[model samples]
Target: MASRLAQLEGPIDTVYADIYNESGLRKETTLSKELGFKGKLIVHPAQIKIVNEVFTPSKSEVEQARKIIDAAHKAEKQGKGVVNLDGKMIDLPVIKQAEAILEYYNRLVINNQ
Candidate 1:
């Protein structure tokens, strides 16, 4: 169904429907992230922390993003838009995603402060 909706000429975002069962909710959050869902819906207050932790970028992920951004900047300075980072292609979309992860991390830090 998600693939079908994606085939249409509009945006399609994933929304999780499961709202109960703590273990199940955790599993759903992991699956949702793997499936590229931006966020998930939760019914219980207890689920909030777990869901947030699951969705937020990890320390290693944030570090990797920073590295990718730095490498991309260096590549751009060399008149190249795409960069080779650890055998992976670092392009515009990948850079944008890294920027977004950093932005999200900054937001969380600000909120906590």
Candidate 2:
């Protein structure tokens, strides 16, 4: 099931696992997050905290995304189409992804507060 989910393109969201067991749910939620799931479906109220913690982007992830956007902007200002960041090439797709991550992070912050 996870392998099949991995093959799908675009933003994948809402994975489900056993809801009765908090430990098992946490593990599955973490695994789902690692596999690129944007969120999870919760059948129990107790599951919410674990799923939210697993899916929220870390501070380092947000920082790295900011750096990616900054690098892309710098490249554009220099009349270059792409830039190398941390030895990896940053292009349109990567820039868009960084933008999406920051956008998602912002939305989460706004909604949570």
Q: What is the number of residue pairs that collide in model 2?
A: 0
Q: Write the residue-wise lDDT of candidate 2 on 1-113 in tens digits.
A: 56446765434455455667878888887887777667777777878888877777778888999999999989999999999999999999899879988988888876779
Residue 42, model 1: lDDT of 68
Q: List the residue pairs that clash in candidate 1.
A: none
Q: In each prediction, how many residue pairs overlap at the backbone (N, C-alpha, C within less than 3 A)?
A: 0, 0
- Candidate 2 is scored at a TM of 0.77
Off by over 4 Å in 1: 1-20
What is candidate 1's lDDT per residue for 14-110, written digit by digit as tens?
A: 4445555668777877887777665676666777887889878899999999999999989988999899999999999999889988988888765
Candidate RMSDs in Å, in order, are 4.3, 4.1
